[model samples]
Target: MQRLTVFLCCIWIGSLMYGEMVAFWRPYWKCSWPPLQQNLTEVPHSHEGFKVAVITDPQLTDYTSHGLTPGSFAVKAIQFFTDIYMRRSFRTSLLSFEPDEIIFLGDLFDGGPYLSDKEWKESAERFEHVFDQTQRGSKSRLTGIPVHYLSGNHDIGYAGFHSHKREVIERFEKVYGETNYRMKIGSVEFVIVNAQTLDGSMNENSTSSSWNFIQNISADANPLPRILLTHIPLYRPNDTPCGAYRSSPIINQRISNGRSGIQGIMYQNYLSEDTSARLLDLIKPILVLSGHDHDQCTVSHPTPNGPVIEHTVGTFSWQQGNLYPSFMLLSVSALSSSTTSNPEGIVSTNLCFLPMQTHIYLWYASLFIITVFLLLSWPTSGVDLSYCFRKLTELAATAIRTTSKGGVKVKDEDANYEYDMVWDAEGVMHLIRKGYSKLSNANHGEVRSSARGTVVARPAAKKQTTPESDSSCVQIESETNLEQIPKGPRMTKGKMSYIVQRLFRTLHNIAVLAAVNLPLYMMLLIKDWT
Candidate 1:
């Protein structure tokens, strides 16, 4: 038990250290820098490119998922651990890449569209806490980095559905700013679009507003390379491939009507074909970035002008059905001279994968199971108690022989007789009777036993014996008499006491183990609870 306890403690400590300090951070160190599409050195005195971190589909847990009940302790606990994980990953990415700006592609909350004002507020608070970089005294590397957010179906519901309530949209915009807007960082221009509105099934006003936003961007003659950021990916043929980084062989394009009463489409795998074509033609974006599938995908859309590459960034949260969650790092350098052959500026993008949290959890679980098995099987693991007792008896016999003084030594022939007559109940009774006869003879008196109508007397011829043999005979007789004595009530009480003692010992062991390891487990879940 002591050994098992030590082993379990070691496992707990090791797991805690690795899972918390090493596992989550090692991947960042190992990740190579994003590969640049074109060498910036060719451009005369090209400046360092702007680095942007693309995070998407965190989809923070809510009442609707993970068997969670609103306002319950379980929900809070799950949220707490999940938030801690996200915070660690996000912080690690920020420190590793040192991105100048961060962009969230969407689905910030799992059930944001359905949450009430109070629930929404709580979820938003959790989101801020997870991504908080400006807390007082926080030396976070991302403290001053600008963050941009796009509206997801989960955040503001799909367009054209009554569930896509005006209140929800307003609340989202109030916190995250306009979902559809344009911003430029360094030499590149980013056009953020709310693709949910492009479905055309939405209200006339919203549909036109989104179109007008796109049209306005398209009409601009700004020569800077344009990048489109949206929550939904542009449409492609049903058989289109999502590239090698995708976990699934094929992207699931099946349309879901969902509970939102948006007939024919509740959630979309990609934007409608017409909407995708229009955006490509009008915006003429050199690159399209989106998130909704929660997996990495790269697709090329053919256009009259040129082929546009679209990268669908994977989810950033480990809970979103992805074992290996990741984010994108994009670096764009604006060329100093537009006259150069390639004027769109050198762009490089890489997918930075976070540690596989599920694997870590499985390792912990396996360790726990192994510990439990060892503990439960410890009692009977090895050693034969009966054999040990027999060895002890033999040692005691040898001790008695060694301590005995010199006496008459029996002949070899007599030794076999003595052994045969001194090892059973009847033989023991005969020995006791014989000794009594000898004592009676020494006293010069006849002996008689009337208890069972039996009589005994010493024989006329006397046999020689050793004092050791006499003492052993007496001891064996006394033990036999004691065994013959009844101890029914005492034995029953002793057995009950033994069972109770064993139960207490098992419980004590389990309690000690739990006490020792509980803190370690809690540290893994809430290391930054404050």
Candidate 2:
């Protein structure tokens, strides 16, 4: 039993410590762990598998008010604390994934609606600093990965609410290029759409042009596996609201009338009733991806072409509903051209949630486990609970007195100052005394000399005492005098067993402490990273 206990403790301690070290190293340096791979429906075309990192709703901002006023400083201070350092963390995590390409599905800015002329320019500059390709002799957070940006409700405008002017749309297009565009990578056609356009918030001409482009692409004689990327998900599928609907199903049902009573930005943030059906019929996109709800979810709908799967990726913003920052890694295999009727190649997607808050849960779990282990492994004979409590109280008092004096103060009376006495279950009262200085100076030779022949004499107490109690109460003559003390009796078989048990209990306590505190301490060191 002892061997097994020791072995288990070693394993637990080793695992906890190793996890702590990795966690500590992760925040300062990028993690080297491989990205998780998720498998999708297999396509008929033969092609090599490639990785795509999908990040959304970073909503990056300096967070200060858009004015040159005194209050801006206060607002900036508040925003500083609230900012999750999304850029730094995102870069670190993305580097770890080492994706071939990155696709950001919208809401790249939080204060887009409030931006002034200067603020707009600054926001554009900040966006480029964080996401744009590296220039000559410049540092780039993205290394060499190609990035595709999409416009969400926060960027330009939704539909009817917080609508942006035509000039604002022009500026966005100028910076990020056409919001609605298509790119062919390998045998796959990625269709990027501006959900804002569908809401009738943008110029009708631009919207019409995009629609025409999509139609033109769909008319291809040899179409590839189409994947659509947008900001808002299709109108609530499987009765699960992913867009601007209220979190509660009952509330959503009450508010969602025939036309969806949601007004303005919220309305534009979600698709209209027949929006998905129309898009599905037009493009026949097998896979559709979106973001803007900040909720990670997946739903499938059957169409004339095949099954269309829609996924809403989670957010990296703490300002949003993203309690834990996360992103998706998409793995797309090469398309096989054999018997191609728009080959449905397998596209695997893994939603990788960051382990930022995992340490908190692990700390709580470790504490609970340590408490249980201590209770079950405590030495009952050598350590008395009441005695331990008393000792702890006395130690606290001594510490308080020592701190007040700036150092330990020694009393003149008999070198050892008596503080208090504690009576045990055996009716034997042990007088607690302290003579820290002399105790430290006394050597083993002195202890042996004192034990050999020294005997102490003191005034007899004015209380009844038994013969064994009198023999046990041999008072010390001086500070160095620690005469042969009575420890109840010699070591018998039972006493030896008790000693061995206490030894094991001590080891158990040490092991349990290591298991409980190592990870917690490491977590404290990294809690400020993100």
Candidate 3:
């Protein structure tokens, strides 16, 4: 307990002592990690007071949904989200920041637009009430502040991703009044990015015009500052040469020398991932604001020196999984409402910050190191080893029980799987087609289902893979009646039992590690004591 207290104290002090700096380090921090900057030119226009405002994750789900669900998230459905990140809270937070404008990072709803048309109506109603108050509040601000928003993975996932962004723009415009547009306020060139551009996989043609517009603005502008707004982080912990978006392909070719799709940029690029780099290099904006993850953390990347900041917004919905809700306030200043006046914002310059990284990697490493030492000392220190031995035995039993004699668990023929895409159109369609599997279960000609839920059995299903009547592999003999097909459970509940077994196995492995490390730790301790 004493040691634990020390550990906690270290963390508290570490956080306060942490500072911001440049992201130009060999390893950049995750997007929100270090608020670092460099090569930035903050030239001020003669605007009034400093502009600061707040933006948070307001996950206002459709009232009917109440943000409830089944799946890993089903467990979290008991809580009402609207009460958690209400617009009033956002209003109060903004009022405190007293900035010129407030930008929402997205996930306006839990993500889905409802399988049935009826659901959309409900979601629409709840969403309107949440956003309307804010729109009205913006008008009440001393500056009659403008409110901006960026689409997140959840906002358009139900609409087939970028494909339906335009279709939903009207709905959003009705609530918040726009999808992608830009304006210049007191020298700051604030460009609101569309949702599609953030997804690295988006087709280039869709984003080309947006980029061209910004380039034109940069060419004509003078001493004004630049700011780009969007949701989802621009970088990850694992980043190679692949910089954010525009800088990615350049980095890809440079790193793999033509090889593509190696590993997730989480470790490689750290937070300096794809698409984001392009927006940074092209826009050269002094600030970028985004959201997705629910926690509030600021990483001062590249340097351990002075004050630099990258704004990361927080979550708004309480029902989301592991995602937190929060907002930020940014001050507006020094120019005209028109884009022509100040080229840059009233303030811009070289950034500085000192980073005291939590380094979760090292945190876990130390825990393992200590655990190993404890394991080594346990037996000789006269502590019972049965807990340790029992754990190992249980793990081995789990490994044996889950595996098939030949080794390989198979999926049901009718398992419904969809793309890893934040967009789950087919999943929504399937939900709408509820009991389609059960109805067809009696008729084996189509997919099959059973009494138990083994919800998504397939690894991934692509839009292109939907079976068409003309498929060569499927026979279409008019003589063969569809009624003569076999029907049975696609898969049994027995298969999912593997989860319990897997857990035990993992625990067993930890026990083994402890057992192996115990003796070494005790030896060192005894030597010191002697």
Who wins the lDDT comparison?
1
User: What does the lDDT come to for candidate 1?
Assistant: 0.74
The stretch of ten residues in a row with the least summed lDDT in candidate 2 is: 249-258
For residues 153-201, could you state the per-residue lDDT of candidate 3 as single tens digits?
A: 4554311333434445445556665556776765466777653443322
TM-score, every prediction:
0.73, 0.56, 0.42
**Candidate 2 has what TM-score?**
0.56
Q: Which stretches of candidate 1 lie over 4 Å from their true place?
A: 39-41, 44-46, 66-68, 135-141, 162-164, 201-203, 256-265, 336-345, 379-509, 523-526
RMSD of each: 11.2, 17.5, 28.9
Global lDDT scores for all candidate models: 0.74, 0.60, 0.43
Where is model 3 poorest over a 10-residue stretch in terms of lDDT? 19-28
lDDT of 1 by residue, 1-530 (tens): 66667767877887877787677677677775564455445755555668888899999997786767787998877777678888888765545566788999989999888889999999999898888776424455457788999999899877655334668888999999997999987677889988877875544556678888887887776556788998999997887877888885567566666454544346788887888898899888889999998888999999998788899988988888888898888887655325234423456788878878888889988987786666656663545769999999999997777668344444443321122122233323343323412233233334444333333333343444443433333232222356767699988999899777666666676688778778876766565545
* Residue 419 alpha-carbon offset, candidate 3, angstroms: 90
Q: Give the per-residue lDDT of model 2 (tens digit) for 1-530.
A: 34435555565555555443444336334333232222334332343467788888877655433343533775565444334245434544554566778898988776675567677787776665554344412334446778888987778765443333556667778777788889875456789987766745334655566577767876888777778998977766345644332232311211122235533333434677576677778777868998877767777768887678788887866556556666787766554433233323346666666544444347657855774565456546435658889999999999998999988664455333222243433345554332232223332211212433543222221232222211233343334534665355554766888767767676666666567666765563355332
Model 2 segments more than 4 A misplaced: 1-48, 62-71, 78-84, 129-142, 161-164, 201-203, 241-266, 337-344, 357-530
Which regions of candidate 3 are displaced past 4 Å?
Answer: 1-50, 62-81, 91-93, 96-99, 112-118, 131-145, 158-160, 163-166, 173-175, 198-205, 221-223, 239-274, 300-309, 321-325, 335-530
